[model samples]
Target: MTDRFSQASGTSAVGGVERRSTRSWSGVAWPTLGVGAILALVPLWLGDSRVMMGIAVLGLAFAAYTIAFNLIFGSTGQLFLCVGALAGIGGYGGAILADVVGLPIVVSIALSTSAAALAGGLLSWVAVRRSLGVIFTGIVTLIFALTFENLLLGLGELTGGESGFLMEAGRGTFLRSQIPPYYLMLGMVLLTLFVYGSLRRSRFGWAFRALRDDEVAAELAGIDVARYRIFAATIGAAILGLAGALLAFTEGRVSPTTFGFAEVDVVVLVMLAFGGIGSFLGPILGALTFTVIDELLVEVGQLRVFIYGALVIALFLWLPRGVVPALDDLLRRRRAGS
Candidate 1:
């Protein structure tokens, strides 16, 4: 009877923690959701389809991707450098399934996402399961990224290779414009945020936090470091892959240039560095800020790259952990002073 009672109490305590987490997330979510709603309406005021589609919609997609990256590197403390490549795998896989194999869009996306998840799990097993150090693990993933790029290029007939290929736009349209995809991307961003918050509150999250802080201690605590590392990697990759499938549908094309290592991998890392990793607002803020900056600098052509590089350096110098954490610290200080 005592053992049973103890188990019941433990379960209830876990339940209470979950409830508190939900409440905490709800407190933070309201402001973020309100801001997002306002941004969603901005497209109507601006009345520019290019701006709406290019910056707003694509930024939403990239935010999802960035969140995925942050989870693996920031939360789990495992640096898997194949973010865009997994996304591309999902993109190309779904495109082929939907466009070529005549599968339904839903089925195509599901299958592709599953494929990405499997790949992520396999990557974790191959790279980190043997207890490889962090730097070597990154190198292995980077090699996978390079290999994936080559595979896509080599499979010209399927993935359009260097020349690129257009997707059949038979579905995913709304009101004869890009609005539907925009909303779709927005929905995805919200979903990713929701999952991120839930994870942040769960025992899984605590495990990640512990693992990130000290693997040996986490293992001693019975956290199963290898299992959770794979969990984080697989979950993040699945989110990224799903975003890629959505992007393939949105952009209506698959190409090598779209998923280049330097093009996406570096850009995402820089965005995370700018946004503050391991925080909920970091990925969204970073992706949106960079996308807008990119749009503004569009007319400047080559100068934009130089400016971006300079800005990143400056941002690091000014706010080492990115904007959100710095802002959070400022708010805390102000409150304490008051």
Candidate 2:
């Protein structure tokens, strides 16, 4: 009777936590969708300027990247430093499959996405097997990123070297059009948000939080830490792959610069940091804010990277928890006072 009662109580407690998580996510879901709706209307103002529209598309891409990073790092504590490399794998892989192999773009995207997921899963498996902590995982992934960049530079004949590979695959299609590409990327952003939110409301979210809060405790509580972390990494990597593949198609080229670590990974980390690491709307907010900042600093030229480096240090030092969570705390304080 005692064992049965204890088991029943534990089940109820777990159920209560899930219910609370669902409610918490539900409160934020509509606002997230509203933000997406607002972004969808951006073509209304910038439709005439191709340059602005291009910047907007790039912003959405970065937003998607941050979201993927958030899922891997924030949810499960896997610090993957090769965000750009995994993305480059998809971008370069898709372009090669379409242009060189003469496969349909859709087929190429699927294959490249699958390849990225497998690669991500393998990386996660290796990390788990080695019992690597966050810093070690980042170090290993950073090495992978460096190797990928060198590979692009070395394989001049195949990858077009630093000149970039012109994607004849998406040429003359709607992807080349100015407006359609914006909506296409917007769709991806919204889809990614939905997926993230859904995971946060499901059993996966519970497991993620458990492991994130304390891996040893989670393990004691019967949570499979390795499996959940790898699953999160795989899912996040698939999103990154899909986003990268689409970016290649829309941009009509793939270059080392396009998916370089300094370009994609650093910028994404800054965005994720500024917006809030674990907050639902944090990545979008950070991406949007930094995208505009980046465009504004375009005239500064070479100095822009220096400025970003400074911002990364400052933001991490002062706003470690990020703007979204900070603001959320302030709001709660005000409500309590009222």
Enumerate residue pairs that collide in model 1. none
Give residue 125's lDDT in candidate 2 (0 to 100): 91
- After superposition, candidate 2 runs with Cα above 4 Å error: 1-29, 335-338
For model 1 the TM-score comes to 0.88
RMSD of each: 7.3, 6.4
- Write model 1 residue lDDT over 1-338, tens digit each, in one string: 11111111111211113324444667446645864697678568654665456557668878988989888887776678898899988888888999999898889999998899889888887766677667887999999999999998898888778876888844546512556667778878887877876787667777876776677888998988888888888999999889988888777787876677877887788788777766666777888888888788889999987987887787666655676656656776788799
**Window of ten residues with lowest summed lDDT in model 1:** 1-10
Q: Could you estimate the TM-score for every candidate?
A: 0.88, 0.91
Whole-model Cα lDDT of every candidate shown, in order: 0.75, 0.84
